[model samples]
Target chain A: MVKVTYVAHDGTRTELEGDPGDSVMSLAIANGLDGIVGECGGSMMCATCHCYVDDDWQAATGARMDGEEDMLESAVCEVTGRSRLSCQITLSEALDGLVVHLPEEQV
Target chain B: MSAGRVVIIGAGQGGLQAAMSLRQEGHSGPITLIGGEPGLPYQRPALSKAFLKTGEADKLALRPESFFATKDITLRTGEWVDAIDREAGVVRVGAEALPFDHLILATGTRNLRPAIPGIDRALDLRTLDDAAALRAALDRPRKVAVIGGGFIGLEFAAVAAGLGHEVSVAEAAPRLMARAVSPEMSRRFRELHEALGTALHLANGVTEVTETGLTLADGTEIAGDLVLLAAGVRPNTELAEAAGLEIANGIAVDAELRTRDPRIFALGDCAAFPEPGSGRRIRLESVQAATDHARAIARTIGTGTATPYAAVPWFWSDQSNLKLQIAGLADPTDDSVTLEDGAVLRFRDGRLTAVETINNAKIHMKARRLLAAAPVPTRDSLLQRNYDLTAA
Candidate 1:
């Protein structure tokens, strides 16, 4: 299981354990984490699970694909250079200590 | 008056969301979710995309089994609701009669099977069971003949071709996705599918489904091991229709998502609600519409706030490397303005009706917000800024 930390907009952090191959969006939904609506269930169709990857772990998260980048641009929250769709980021042992900040709102 | 008990039919995305939203909206009432499918409500969109690629059904579940138990939501699966007893205020599931203070019809839709010889031989991709069967068929190398060049068919063709299977798409219309996209966008998709090695048969329709292949209307035969019917879908409105509720393209609902009987409401693919700005009765099959409609209905049922449903409609389809995102609604006759980056802005009578983007979610989102503005952006306003929606 990969240990991932989801920080809410208000700076409230929730550490959760996610199995490898599961998306961070699924993990958030499974654990009942607020601020990650995941309306489209990781299809990248809905940008409801927008998250900002911590600057330190940005490189580890790697670059966003064109599809993912397009989704981020449509995200209800402000898209930053560090912004990423949690659905596109799969949980892996290599990124065990991943930290992502949830946006304020996801429409 | 708050609903004492809410009974939701179909138990799909919209039904499940209505149940969840009711609770979230502070409705401390008994919620019963009845589904025709055998298991929990799962994400239907992933069945064609990620689930086909990964074969992980568990990952597509919208909520875990424990969610219902914890939330005091009663989920009954594998049961088909047969009829709605309007006067009795109950729904009939075979011999059982389930009563409700308020009833929500989220019966969703089913694939439209054309009246062709041996049409039963063709498979569908609407349900999880259908996807599972399709996936099992894809386990071995097989030739796939898709009946429709719409989103589902194209998405399935992409996956089949990606998996090294021979695929052919037969679309009756001159262009692909003709109902939802512009000519330019359709041409681009045709190119994408052709480049992916999927044979395109546009302006031609299947006349018959043979055991080994399908015969076109013009007597052209396409050889294939498996046939898929992705032509389109029809709303499941038998219950509402039988009960004497208004039925047009779907179950007709008013601005508040209420049927002729205020106690009965409908949403999702089954309900034809008026388009927010245009007032045109439209039935959407997207997850965004389902969730948004559920939320609006739940708010009205739970908090007694009869706010008319007005959320922006957006949709996306993932076919191979291309991701098509559409914001707002567009008719086939709507004029389109193509941008330099390949995004198409649809306009009707000078007002923006929709925006279609290929792998451009930023512009799609911008268009959705812009269209939802108090006074929608017009053709002049958009052209003045060169279609830069953010320049408001």
Candidate 2:
């Protein structure tokens, strides 16, 4: 199992396990975490799954995908350099300790 | 309505979102989500788009079973709601009478069965079971005839074509997606499917659905092994209508999403509320509108504070490699102005209506923000800024 920690805007932390092929957004949604709406069901049609990778884990998680930046423009909160759509991030053994912070709102 | 027992009829996206949002808003009352479909509530958007290719049913689930159990949400699946007793404030489900302090009608829409002979021969693609059957039928290379040129039909056609099947789309309108998109966009998509070897029979309505395929209104017969009925959908307003609730295009609701009866609210594809800016009654069949309406309804019931549902309407369609996104609402007669970037700006009576883009998500997002702003950008104002949504 891959361990992922989701930090909400209010600083609440949630740790969950996911399969190697599962996405962070799907993990948050399946576990019913308050943050990360995943409104588009990881289709990247909606940016409700926007999240910020913990700075230390940025390099391990890699950069955004081809069309992720454009989709992020529709996110309800402020977009940051570390911002990435959680749906685009697939879990793996190397990134077992993936840590992501959720924005204040995702509508 | 604060902290009252909430009963939602329809466990689709909107219904599930209402239960979640109610809990998020700190509602402590018992929440019952009744769905006619068997199993946990899942999203319907991907049924025609991705599920046809992947067949990953687990991925479509909006929430896990554990989430419902932990949230104390009573999810009754495969249960048909018989009727709504407005005077009694209870809904009849078989022999049980489930009472509710507040009832949310999110019945959604159903596929429109046109009055064509042998229509039963054509398979539907609305539900997961329907998609599963269609996907199974596509296990072998088969000639496919899709009756409709709208989003669902085109999407299924694209997937079937990509899978090496002989596909043809017959649309009754002169142009594809005529009701939802502008002429230029319909042209672009026509060119796209044509390039993919999918024959498009525009302005041709299916006169009959035969075992071999479909016969068009123009007396042309398209031979195919598989026939898909994707003509369109009609709002599921029978229950609302039978209950004596006022219904226009759909179950009529106010700006606050409440039906004539204060304790009941209708929303999502099943309900038609006044358009935010124009006050024109309209019904949208998108996940955005459904979930957004659910949130607004939740706010009113969960917190005892009513707020008008004025979220900017947006939609997207994935056909082949192109992503057609529309930011706002546009009438069939809205004027279309194509920009150099290929994004079409729709206007009516000199006021900007909707922004349509193909494979351009940035401009689509910006257009949504612009449309949501007060004093909506005018066509002349947009022209001065070179049609750049960020400038306005």
Candidate 3:
């Protein structure tokens, strides 16, 4: 199991354990985590699962693909250098203790 | 009063959503979802995208089979709805007739095949089986000829090209995605496809689909191992038409998404509802439109709230690395102004009609919220702000 921490916009952090191969967006949805609406069900067609990776874990998350980068540009919240779409990030054992910040709105 | 029985036809996105939303809206009525296709309803949009790359049909299911049983929703799969017996308030599937107090028609659309000789030789990319066949065809490197340059055609073309297969898109329209996107945006996509090594044959209609390839209207022969027919779609309006429902391009529905027969309603690609603000009836084929329409209809049926369906329409297309997103609707003749950030703002009669963006989700979401505002921003105001939507 990989432990993932989702930090809401209000600075509230919720830690959850997910099996490998489960996408961050799917994990959040499964746990009923607020602020992440996987409207397109991880298709990457919708940008409703936008999140900001913790600065310390940026390198661990790897680089965003062109498709994901394009999708992040459409996120409702402010997209900075750390912005990423949670659907594109698959949970893995190496990603244990990964921390991501949830945006205020996904739309 | 007891919640009446709700019957839904065509278990696509809209049909399934209607059943789920009805229950969410506190409707305790018997809900029966009849689908012509086998298995639980899956996401159709992925058939042309991820399903092509992964070839995983199981991931496409919107809900697990157990969810239906748990929700007490009766799901009838592999059963084609033959006719609607309005007088008896029942839908006929062969000899079986299921009674319903209220009906929701979400029959969806079928691929529109052009009148080309040997067109049957071409494969489609609409259903799960079609996608599986397409994925199998992509196993070996071979030339692929796409008959249309629309979203599905381009998406498949991009995927096929990315897999190192030679691809050529033949579009009858002078420009790519002529009906849905602006000319500038179309040109951008044309370049994107060309850069990916896919050939673009604009304004070239297929006259014949030979076993080996296709022949264009101008007598141009394109050789390919496989041909994909993604030209367009025709709404499944035959069911509604036979039932004596108003059909204008699609089954005509009022602002509240109700058909002329008060007990029945239509939504999604098969229903032509009046466009907000303009009042001109338009048929939109998008997941957002279908889901929102279902929610609105469910509210009316469950809570007695006949709130007019007025959600802003949005759509997206993924081709190669480019993600083109459009918020709100735009007429083909709408005037467009390109912003400094590469987003296109479309306007009709000085009113903002749509915003087209390539990989820009922030602006797209803002455009949706702006369009849905009580006093919509004007084109002049947008121009004055140099297309800064936030300023408007």
The model with the greatest lDDT is 2
How do the residues B46-99 of candidate 1 rate in per-residue lDDT, one tens digit apiece?
A: 888978888888777788888898888999999988888988988888999988
Task: Look at candidate 2 and give me any clashing residue pairs.
Answer: none
Best by DockQ: 2
What lDDT does candidate 1 reach at residue B213? 92
How should the candidates be ordered by TM-score, best one leading? 2, 1, 3
Per-model fnat list: 0.47, 0.72, 0.12
Per-residue lDDT value at B179 in model 1? 96
- Residue-wise lDDT of candidate 2 within B1-392, one digit each (tens)? 36799999999999999999999888999999999999999989899988999999988899989889888999999999999998888999999999999999999999999988999999999999999999999999999999999999999999999999999999999999999999998999999999999999999899999888999998999998999999999999999999999999899999999999999998799999999988989999999889999999999988898979999999999999998989999998999999887899999988888999988877887888888889888889988988778677
Local error of candidate 2 at A84, Å? 0.8
Can you tell me which runs of candidate 1 are displaced by over 4 Å?
Answer: A5-15, A32-35, A51-84, A97-105, B1-3
Isolated chain B TM-score per model: 0.98, 0.99, 0.99
DockQ of each: 0.48, 0.73, 0.20
Which regions in candidate 2 have their CA more than 4 angstroms from the true location?
Answer: none
The CA lDDT at B214 in model 2 is 91
